[model samples]
Target: MIPRAVSKNGYAVLNAEDPLVYKMKELVDGRVVCFSMDENNPTIKRRAERGRVSCVYENGYVTILKGKWKVRVEKASNIPLTYGGRAEFMIQNVLAATLACFVHGISIEDIRVGLTTFNAGTAQTPGRLNFIEVGSCTVLMDYAHNPAGFSGLVNFISKLPNKYRTVVINVPGDRRNDDIREMGEIAGNNFDRIVIRAGHYLRGRDASDIAALIQEGINRTGKEPQVRIIPESRDAIQHAIKYARKGELVVTLADIVPDDISHVQEIRDQILKKQQATEV
Candidate 1:
């Protein structure tokens, strides 16, 4: 749909770092604008070789390079949506949107303003890196269920400077057992502690089945992660919060967005109340 929409003299923005984006360019009949993390990525080089119209990237700064006109905007760290540039995937999104606007003849000043002001909160982008702070700990709540999403989150989590890390996670029963284990493996690699919980809405597998598969993945990592099997999602969250310490980062990989979000928020409120009492 994207390639066809821009097939008729319209501008198309592609992720120059993604190999699939290069194939997608074949479907696009108009000028292909590209965005990438690095300016020297093979896809970006390929796009340039193919005479693509424009490209946006971060080579120390958010830069847009076209044929003869070049515009360098504020660094991604200044953009709230990029989470101080820790969310590398979001930085790619910002690049794509910026390049698309540039193709549409939007002023560089306007694009810069939009990039700086754009906010990604629970309301703005729910179930995707909703950072919640309770006292001194930072809790990241996300609904990353697939391998790709988990991989992206693992990268972001690795960059967080925390004394300890905990992950409350579950995968849907409908997914292949291997896939569920892979998610666990990824979490195990990054987190110091882990809680395997039921998603509360399993897509039709017996209780403990999915959790067991995830455990298999966790154990395969060879890292002696402090592990727990809490079947209920809410209970798992409560367990995580109970043992959470200051400077620790708790990541909840929720399967059901709405239910998990409500439960997390409730836990956050409880933590706040406890903190208030301690302060008193």
Candidate 2:
């Protein structure tokens, strides 16, 4: 007897040991026969009229009926692995392949290869746990804006060596006034100085109003930490950097901007140049 496996996308395979399964073990194949929003396709209608195999796609599965044999909807969830699991496996495989290539193909016998070198390099990847030393202060750039991200960044920075005060600049563009205010409250309890700037609001909301909304949230929190409103992003950054003393952290919240808007690279470069000039 051949075992049968079903998938959420309406695919069924009989006999796990079948030759077809062996040949296509690494591939996922499916076909969409018809797509209709309001009405069924003429072919499906004809099939139903002829009392042949009838199937309907819904909720990532297909419901099929063939004479007395009726098959319930089979979705991707019916499969042993989900789409998310497959994607995660592929990512892990890629990382493994890259590591194997470096370990087996490269010869690093010349320079002293120490475990600390790999540890330090791995710690510096963006969106991962990374830190930048600016004068006596350590700045961390992370892709965290939600409540979870904000909390994680604050917690991590708090544990760093000599971390006295935390300055969080949270400007989540897609957040509602209430959401932004909640984020402000979260920052208020954690950081010493909280700077709220208008981020990328693509929905045509007034930028100043968004800033004010965040300020309202801070006011509600009742934790005063030198809250400043600088509309220009570069100036806001400069303000944070100027006031940052040794043993303090400055966090800048950034969002994805549309193609039409100008990039902040120029502003960043100007700030860096100005900082260097000021130092000298």
Candidate 3:
């Protein structure tokens, strides 16, 4: 779609750090502009030297230094979708969208307004790091079913300040055993507690098969964190929350996002009711 979009005389906003994007840039005749978080990326550096790049973003600031205009926008965290900067991937997404708009002659103020107004909520972007507060615990629910997604979530979770962290995860039956194993290893290394659950879509394997494979992977790492298999995803979530306390986080890599989110909201409501009763 990207290459086809540029073929029709539309400007292409390339991720300069991506080698595939660099190759695509070479094949397109239409005006191609680049954006990058890293100034040192060879493509961005080369384009910036030739004044062909549209925008350069780093940390949370974006600069547009193309065409005879220079503009800078700082505090990308002002974009509500980034969750106060905890969702680093969302920041990059905002940068890319902002750069795309700028290249298409959109006003800076409009782009800024659009970004700051966007929020990641259940209604807007369900199953993508939907944050919920249960009593004193923070729960992050996401549809991260693969190793790459798991790694990114773990990296994000590691930065949050919490006394203990719990993760709800399950291995997809269709995934390679090594991939499933890697997911378990990542959870084991990053979280203090883990709940292995079975999602609605098993992809062919029996109920206990995926859990056992994931557990085997976790055991291979030699870390003895608190881990259990609850089989049902919803029950696993409830189990995690039952033991959660203040200054803790529960990150759920949900397989069934809608069901998981509904269950979490129900759990949150119950927590709120209990707290209200105690206070009253």
Candidate 4:
């Protein structure tokens, strides 16, 4: 249905690295412009060799290859969303978005400005890896609920400086048991500590039941991290942030993004006030 929906002149932005998504290239009714994090991807390479258009992450830049012409939109390090080129998923996102804009006749300089100017953690997009610092603790708030979403967060976390990483996860009650479990397993495998927040929009599942299911999956990993369930999201956030020391990270997969961000912002404000008082 996807390919069939496109007119012959329409553009289909496809991912060459994803086998399933790349397969759509064969079926697309419109012109296909592929993007990939791998510059040397066989399909993308072949497209470049044949004088076709492709976007790739070559060296440090998000480069567009138009037959021998290399147009670099921006370096991943310069783009705040990619988190200093460490967030591999964001790199792919940048590639796709840059290619989409380019095909629509957006200039390279405009694309570069957009990439460098867009800050995901601002008030406009607070639930996207917004960091709040309180003394030694680095608290991150994001709205990662599903397995894939948590997996992306985990990928970003892996790129962060070595620290005692603890994730305060809140799985939506409405998701499938498998999805919740998968998120739990991902957190278990990656984080050093896990705090499960049981509140808001649990659908039909009981709070305890939801927490237990996640803990069950975490048990499968044989990791040392233990599961603790907090019935209140605020308390869960506090618990995760309170005990963190220097060189430690506290990640909160928020159930309510606004509430979570506001709560952390207040915490940060209090800490800043106390620090100022101490200096005086």
**What are the runs in model 4 whose C-alpha is more than 4 Å off?**
1-10, 24-30, 49-51, 274-280
lDDT of 3 at 280: 97
Residues 100-197 of candidate 2: C-alpha lDDT, one tens digit per residue: 22323333221113211332111333333334555556555555666656765565555555555655454555776677776777778777887666
How are the candidates ranked when ordered by lDDT, highest leading? 4, 1, 3, 2
lDDT of 1 by residue, 104-199 (tens): 888889988998987877888788788888656777887788888889888887887887999998887778888988988997788888998877
Q: For model 3, which pairs clash?
A: none
- The best candidate by TM-score is 4
Rank list by TM-score: 4, 1, 3, 2
Write down the worst ten-residue block by lDDT for model 1: 51-60
Point to the candidate with the largest lDDT: 4
Alpha-carbon shift of residue 64 in model 1 (angstroms): 1.8
Q: Whole-model lDDT for model 1 versus the true structure?
A: 0.80
All models: lDDT?
0.80, 0.48, 0.79, 0.84
In model 2, residue pairs whose N, Cα or C atoms come closer than 3 Å (at least 3 residues apart or on different chains), thus clashing, are 7-75, 8-75, 8-76, 9-75, 9-76
* lDDT (tens digit, per residue) of candidate 4 on 1-280: 5865767988888889888887887887789999988888999888988888889999999999987789777889999988899878788889989998998899999999999999878475778878777677888888888987788888888888857988888787889988888888898899888998886888888888888888888988888795678888878888877777677899988777888888788877877899999999
